[model samples]
Target chain A: MDYRARFLVDPLKKLSLADIDPDDTGDIDKEKAAELTATYLQRMEEDQFLLYADGRQSLLVVLQALDAAGKDGVIRHVFSAMNPQGTRVHGFKQPTPLESAHDFLWRAHAHVPAAGEVVIFNRSHYEDVLVVRVHDLVPREVWSQRYEKINAFEHLLAENGTRILKFFLHISPEEQLERFKKRLDDPRRHWKISESDYSERKFWPQYIEAYEEALVKTSTLTAPWYVIPANHKWFRNLAISQIISETLDEMGLELPPTRVNIDEIKAHYHAAVKATENKKSD
Target chain B: MDYRARFLVDPLKKLSLADIDPDDTGDIDKEKAAELTATYLQRMEEDQFLLYADGRQSLLVVLQALDAAGKDGVIRHVFSAMNPQGTRVHGFKQPTPLESAHDFLWRAHAHVPAAGEVVIFNRSHYEDVLVVRVHDLVPREVWSQRYEKINAFEHLLAENGTRILKFFLHISPEEQLERFKKRLDDPRRHWKISESDYSERKFWPQYIEAYEEALVKTSTLTAPWYVIPANHKWFRNLAISQIISETLDEMGLELPPTRVNIDEIKAHYHAAVKATENKKSD
Candidate 1:
């Protein structure tokens, strides 16, 4: 199945978040996803090497989700397959006074991928239209215009050879509550629990509204947004890995041509061998 | 005389660099400019204090010029009046390997002003359109589209509370030759000379055409471009300083209201003084 077409936010057709079931695992079972993910991860690793070697193109993977939607899980399970040298992750939190001083995009623009680089935005510029809007951080007019600004920004990146892939991790409210309960029950996961985890849950409906609008408005040919079924963590990993590996394949990553003459190097190697033989005779 | 009106590139009318004589110093003489500059600098110094205290707006001054057009001179003579803490200057040189990997505007965008800050681009993103176009560094199709990109970038800056003032320091080829000769004749200025200085002079007409097109295409109400005649160094300083000071004045840079009560603080000061008096008596 073409995961890109399956998960891509349809622009012509108005999408309501309620219509897409987070619990839907499609035809793939957890066992099948576990088996398939390994193959996808293997291809992704090899493809990443070619991407780094090519050193002309870039990839920006943006992940947007509600609280406890398993954004980090996707990164750890999926992105960790690739070499860390060329891959970077930026997680957006509350803006600093210095960051707030400039335009909203200032901080994000600083961390964009360079040539032969892969950058992941754990939560990205979409937050300006998502959290910033849901919480009333700015006026409605201010946040409303950001949809175009974001599209323009992404367009700028796209035109400059940065392939953009955005994923909205869709999780049912029940799944989020379970995840929060798990965090409370487990000491290893205790650090992940925050006051915001519970407090922000109240804004779920507003967040859904904000996110749906941002996805539909900003989705374009160059930078596309995919809504991942994140209720099942294994399924989320499988779907995301499939989409990314396919995208990397589409990048046409190939090693650059070498200018060195191989025959001349072989002659030098023979000459060195002869010299060693001459020294032994002497 | 409104220096803003005097030098602003009229967008409705076609602008030819040849028609604007570089030697035209208007009614200002060296002695008069020297006096008027001191007054402008005083107001500017005070205004910058209010701006920094207000901490909401920002200023970005872009200087675009040919070789020996004295971009550094403006920074040294005029901008030196403001406190170094709030003011910064970025001189755009040849792009580094990493910088070249990204878009042309990427490097420039990284250094845009934060709130209540003053940033001066010695030679700015315009080089992408000017030098990049003149020398055919990129295809005409590629360089041609950069005008709209640059305008969009400036608009982004403008709408985000950054006041953009771009000055194209107009200098004649003869004046540039004379300046280059001065660099050779004076040992103190020998470090400023480069092979590109003389070689670049060969493309004077092409440079003018590139500049004319860039100015016309990019000149906007929010971010206006001024063609400052730069044959007379003092006149250039006088005109630029006049324009900057007037703009800053119009920004209505009032200090943010103090949240503390001065009378309560004064009462505590008096009580502390009385305690000190009692201690002396003991």
Candidate 2:
């Protein structure tokens, strides 16, 4: 099997950042990475509001990662500069009874970005294929067909004026264990770790296999997944920020012409004062 | 007419730091006011997320104010420390065609805060009564009944579990002109001003009348309105922060217990490591 298919059977435990040869090929310095990431994030924030004022297009950011691989941190740090007015971030946890009753896409569909706004899904519709497939939560046949369903769903969104950016944070099993333990020892971080996280770790191989297959089948031009190496947090943030800034810049949105008329305002203020004075005399 | 009814005839405006007779009355120092507000806000941010994690009550903050009365500044500054995870801010603008078709409360209902979360409405359901009444956009008969409708709607939310805090920033008409001109004079501040602001000033008497009536009719014990004196930003922020912190503290929400068994986690980690070794040997 190729690298994509190999990942499916490739138990998540087998893939550690230590296993990858950093010096052999592609990597950047952490400090440089953080600076670049912050700069690009600032630009993305300004551009997001500019696009909103222009009322041209909507944006959807989809983040998928293994447990403890920095999805929450990415959301907090990457888009913190953006105006809350035009941004909505939704973290999709386990499905609720209300959500589970609908089609797999129903909950996600409800969160689609409106025009001139940016919406983020911390984890999204891909869960139908990944988690549902790994845990046998759905029939094998049912989960198998969802790849095409997801592709069609995303294509529909893209055609209807939503630009989608999907990220797959690729981290090795050793790095994940280090993160999992870090969560346990640190009181501030303990809230994030759960029994479910451990339960899922047991089926790491199955999840890896599922993700590999999902990536190839769903990575279309309309919505491509940029797999970021997640051993280094700074590098991961920089890569994602650059991709987001580049994507919005490609969309060519401009700030709206919203200048005020000074003379008219001054005239109105004087009139209000005169009216108030006459009322006082009365 | 009582104060509530009379305020409707003229609505509240800013009472600037210089204008307020500090020497004559019981006024807190400006520095002390700023510190109290900032500290209260920080505490609220901490307590809010803990409550959210524990899945307790929901919080809805409704801010109703005249133009140039510091709504944006309040949002940007007061809630600046809150974690975006448990906080959502919605700035309601002119009604869309779909929104206009529904009853005034319908649009607001869609954005209600969920359990353990806080939602801020920069301007809210009251707009149906205030702006619509001022502009004659809706028939008097239609807009007139909204006060009772709003009170009932908020009451229902309180019964279900939401704590509502409604604030009216009371500013004088004279101060509004100063703030409007300041926006024009500062290049960075230009985006904050709009043409509709001047046009709206023309109907000040009408709006004042609408707000006074609404406040008198709808300020219930369940979701009471705080008439925040708007002349000083520090004082306004301090008052809001104090109110929010007091409300949450009364609820007594604490962080959830981190009770994962250490032996179980160690066992799990070992299993994960063994799986990795086995995969490598394969």
Candidate 3:
């Protein structure tokens, strides 16, 4: 069987990173790829600054993917270039004892991006619906209604100047198994490959179906889900950068005005230098 | 008067970064200084990983300093070396309309370090009492009681497995004015130097008194405030690093053990690689 055919996940298999062709395009020219990647990252950074200056607008980037689907890598390489002053990242994990006491959305809502800030959620509030629905952790009645609840929640955020971007990183089951194996072999990566991740892998087909339905039903113009092809890391990064840059480009922002008090600066500089010179003469 | 004394903030002045020292110790022997700085950073990273492995204890670092007190530089260079997976940073600025509508602690509570995470607050909840009080933005009754309220808020965080480290970067007032003048002269930095900063500088003495009062009242054992010498950049980083490393070292943590089903892994790897190889061969 062909690699793409064997690994590719559709609605039947659901979409998984493990099924896609990792080397789908053979190879591209390294220099051209690097230039393209650099340009994309640079544009993202420039637009981020504009969004920051606008102060009236807030951005929430939700990244959801199967294990080893390159979510961490994308955040590190692409968003790392942004000024820390303007950007914040929140990684959602299992609920803590304290967090469990509150509604699932309470803890997540606290981390929402404020005006003029870019907030990235590594997982996010959708877990209440996705994981809960897939594992049967919550009743069908409870988890099913979360779709409408999520849409409403996002709508509210949109009404209040928060632009939401959701990315479902698509990979195949076969691709995921390989990545999982690599994590086991590599000691440096062992910490990241948890036992729970393996247990979760058993429900791959279920997750895919849940994700597809969620994407179609919940994706709105205000908070749209961009189904990104995660088989290629370079392409995934570029796509994210392009989306972010396009969003910020739409928000008109210019560099803050410059202030000049040159005369005062030169006086201080010369005074300090002369003081040092006098000390040397002494 | 010396630069440091002239720039030392009074009780009335608003805190800005105009006077912070940025040099990484030029006078010290180059190799020795580098080794010391590198050692400090390395130790901090090691301790951070250990604390993360513990998975229960968290840390909150509150940075309070006058203008040009190396807050941003310290964040960039010092914390930059730590593992991103275990650290998060929040830079607090002026309160937004939403933030202002809520309690003073509302915004800060949202960014508390999660279990196994080290969260840095560039500015913090103290702003409501300090800046607002200094500028008379809030009434005497409302802002004055905040000292006790601030202490109570931090006390709660400490009780909940958070080790709070509050730093007051101490630089002389003269040094501040010199740095402010430099910002005005340099076009790249001109945007950062604002008229409000100049206006606040006029009340430097007033701000000092407010800080002294805060330090005396709020410095609890669970959440102590460290007043570091900020005139020397190298010294400040070294001091902060030492404090952070010591805190993490107290928390015992082992590198997470790698577990793999050797036979299962071997079988999976052979099958996957062979499948890929056959396709390539074809």
CAPRI band for model 2: acceptable
Q: What CA RMSD would you report for each candidate?
A: 21.2, 6.3, 7.9
Ranking by DockQ: 2, 3, 1
Q: Pick the candidate with the highest TM-score.
A: 2
Give Cα-based local distance difference scores for all models. 0.83, 0.75, 0.72
Please write out the lDDT profile of model 1 over residues B1-282, one tens digit for every residue.
788998999888899988998998888678988999889988877777667767889999999998889887887678767754456667798999999999999999999988988888989999999999988999999999998999999999989999999999998766776676565555444434455666686688899999999999999999999999999999999899999999999997775654444445345434544654686699
Instruction: Please identify which of the two predictions, 1 or 2, would achieve the higher DockQ against the true structure.
Output: 2
* Tens-digit lDDT track of model 1 for A47-70: 877887788899999999998898
Answer with 2 or 3, whichever has the higher TM-score: 2
Would you estimate the TM-scores of all the predictions? 0.51, 0.81, 0.70
Estimate the overall C-alpha local distance difference test score of candidate 1: 0.83
> Which regions of candidate 3 deviate over 4 angstroms?
A1-22, A25-43, A94-110, A137-156, A186-195, A218-221, A231-235, A255-282, B1-47, B80-86, B90-111, B125-161, B182-195, B209-251, B256-282
Model 3 CA lDDT for position A81: 64
Model 3 residue B184 lDDT?
64
Q: Which residue ranges in model 2 land beyond 4 Å of their true spot?
A: A1-34, A96-102, A139-141, A186-193, A258-282, B1-38, B94-103, B136-146, B182-195, B231-235, B257-263, B270-282
Per-residue lDDT of candidate 3, residues A96-144 (tens digit): 9998899778888898999888888999988888897898888998888
